[model samples]
Each structure stands twice: as structure tokens, then as C-alpha cells.
Target: MITLAGKKALVLGIANNRSIAWAIAQAFHSAGAELAVNYLPDEKGRFEAKVRELTAPLAPAIFAPCDVRDDAQIAHLFETIASKWGRLDILVHCLAFGNKEDLQGPFTQIRRDGYSLAMEVSAFSLIALANRAVSLMPDGGSILTLTYIGSTRVMEGYGVMGPAKAALEANTRYLAAELGKQNVRVNAVSAGPIRTLAASGLGNIHEAIHKTEAASAIKRAVTQEEVANTALFLASDLASAITGQTIYVDCGFSIMGG
Candidate 1:
């Protein structure tokens, strides 16, 4: 019985109905966690509008504009959260991005600008968010992010994201160790390929999905909800002993080999 009653969770990187973050928001809300969901600012407010519609039922405790690249926006987000909730129990970071060209080109050819951008968004943002999160939780809390198998194993078409996620996993360990004494735990969910807006940017993403399903022990790819459910447990007291880990939710695909 995983229950997050009275818990407050900040879920970043929700883009649409298919998004893993959206799924996580739903799961957390369903488990009785107060939610704060983020939508990145866009030219026409399109991205914000989409998240609003998808999370309408959840009625998140807060919906703030966040672009991790902007320090002011990140600072303001935590300030607003402090005003409304005073503290937090869970931080769900599902943010990750790489320039389109970097997703397809030879790994060695990845431009310096593209690599920097990917590492900033996909990796460093965890540290940025976790820093704010720990201050809010006087008692303790959980910090979670999303990653993929490509972080460790080689996968074609994943390109720069591989190194980005690799750094993210490594950061998870460091953050966990630093925050452990504070009773704050940090972890990540390494999910299988899903047909989300983020994954669509990867070259031959559809093929990756199909191949993952075929190779997985269950003979099927896992769902966003499954990943969300795992998140729910981690956010709950059930995972108090777990931290600095990249738990896999890939339907056993991460364990298999050719």
C-alpha cells in the first residue's frame, strides 16, 4: 500500500497527455500528494496551454512557468512554492533535451553548443532543482528524475542524449550522498522508450520502441503509468531506504543482452 497522503510534489517537464511527467502527476495526485506541475514558456503559450488541459483534472497545487535555462524563473518557482506550501516532500524532474541535429549525427560530431545545451537541461537541472527542494523540506524528502538505458548501454540514434543521461545518473548519486544526512533522498527512473514528445526527437524513435518491446522479457514496453507508479513508491515512505539509484522501469529490457 503506497500512499503519499499530505505529500507535496513538484513535477517538471510535463508536455502533454503522453508525457511521463503528466503520468507521474496523475499518479501522485491519485495517491493523495499535493502537486505542483511545470510547463515551459513558449512563443504563443502553446506548451503551457497543453499542460493546463492535460493536468486539469489533477488541479495541481501550483502551475508555474519554468524554463530551467533561466535562473530567475527557477528561483521564482521555488519562491512561489514556498509561499503556497511552505515545504515540499517530492520533486519529480522529467526534463531533458538535445538539439535535433545532435540526436542523429555521429556521436563524435556533436557540436560543443549542442552538447552543452543538452547537459544543461538534461543533467544540471536536477542539481538546480534539488538544491531548492532540500531547503523546503525541513524534515526530509525525495528527488526523482527520468533517464534511459542509453545512459549506459550504447543505442543507435540516441547520440548526445546518451552522455547527457549518463551525467544525470552520476549526479543523482552525488546529490543523494550529499542530501542523505539531511534525510533527503535523490533517485532517478530509467524508463524504456515511449512515444512521448521528447522521444519523438530521437532518430528512428518508433523503431527503438518496437525493438525494445521485442527484446524485453515481458515482450512489451512499459507504460508511462508504470513509471509513474514506481515514482509513487519512491516518493512514499516505502522507499526511504532507497537513494542515489537509477531504478529501471523498462519491462526488464535493461537487464537483457543480445
Candidate 2:
């Protein structure tokens, strides 16, 4: 069994236990990685409280307040990691945001602020985090991000989210190519629709789930566990040779035609 024993991983964007980031953190913890978590300031207590309820049965961990959109916070994060752990072996960025108003309307109707905010927080933030993380990972590591199938295909109500995901996918490839020389592999996991707080922002997420189940080879919606497990593989040494790729854990939904 490939385990991340003795490795240190920073998992960002965990709002609660139901979050995909939390699932990945749980999986990584089970595999023996020392965990460092980051959450928004307003949500830090809730994140820490749930992490306590979840990880108490396991081991103690650190949860830091990080609004990834801030360069100061990002710089401080890597500095803290360096001070505490010396080096990082993995960084999992699962942060994304979009205005509900934009999501509920047509893509052409998206407001300029909503569009820019979506791309900045959801797409460019990954690049920002990776650039800083690479400096702390002197011995080569892995950087994984979350994406969705809406990036490639049109899904109603996905709106600006689809384009944001597309940009994220493109950024992943470019970062992978640029960082490969440094042995810092970068990849994205294009997960299927999982019911989370953020997914509720999409006007028709439930309908999308039903449609995916009807068309996918599995004939069922994917779970957070499935996505988390794939993320574990990519973050582990088991996937040493893989990089600059989008691994879809969509229950074969993307393969469906018509």
C-alpha cells in the first residue's frame, strides 16, 4: 500500500466536513500525512471545530486562517509552513467562488465583477498558491486542485463557473509544464457534481446530478469520497510520473453523448 507516511500536506479551503477539501484531508490523514489546514477568517472556528470532531479520533492538527486572495496571507502561510514543518510534501488547493446571481442567469448576463471575481478567486488563486508553495518544497512535491466537468461541456446554470473551470484546467497544464523541471507536479481533479454548500449556488445542480446519473456509465452520481480518493493517489508518490493532466472522477459522465 502506498502511504504518505512522514509527509506534510497543506489542504486549503475546507469550510466544513462536507467540503471536498475535508474529504481529501481525511483520506490524506488516513494515509499518514501530517496535515495543515487553511480556512477563511470568518469560518476558521467552524472549520477548526469540525476538524476537531473529525480528527480527534486520529491526531492533532493545525488550522490556519487564510484568505487565499491576499498575497500577504499566502506569503505568511508558506512562511508558517517553513517555520513549523521545514518543508511541504503536498499542497491541495480546493478553493473556488462565484456569485450566485451570475450562476442563476445566462453566461452572457454575468456582471463584470462576478466574472472577474470568479476567475480571480477560482482560477488565478491556484497559480498564486502554487508559486508560493513551490518555494517551500525544496525536495519536490505535488500540487493538486479541484475542477469540474462543466469546464469542457455546457451545463445550464453553470454559467461563469464553466469558464472559470476551463481557465483552471488550462492553468494546471501550464503550471505542470513549468514546474515539472523542479519536480513539483501539478494536476487537477475534474470531479462530478457532489452536493456541497458551494454546489447549491448553481441553480440546477440537482438536475445536473440526475441527468449525469441517467447518462453516465455508472448510472449514478459520484461521491466526495471518490473524488478524495483520486486526489490522494495524485498527491502520493504513487503518481510520481503523472503531471499536467486532468483526472475526471465523474462516473463516466463526461463520456456520455447526447
- TM-score against truth, every candidate: 0.98, 0.95
lDDT tens digits, residue span 46-161, model 2: 75566556656546356666887789988888888888888899999898999988777877889999999999999999999998898888889999999998898888888888
Candidate 2: give its CA RMSD in angstroms.
1.7
In TM-score terms, candidate 2 sits at 0.95
- For residue 184, give model 2's deviation from the true position in Å: 0.8
Task: List the candidate 1 regions with Cα displacement exceeding 4 Å.
Answer: none
Model 1: per-residue Cα lDDT over 150-212, one tens digit each:
999889888999999999999999999999999999998999999998899986888998999
lDDT values, one for every candidate: 0.92, 0.87
Residue 114, candidate 2: Cα error in Å is 1.0
Clashes counted in candidate 1 amount to: 0
lDDT of 2 at 113: 93
Model 1: how far is 198 from its true place, Å?
Answer: 0.8
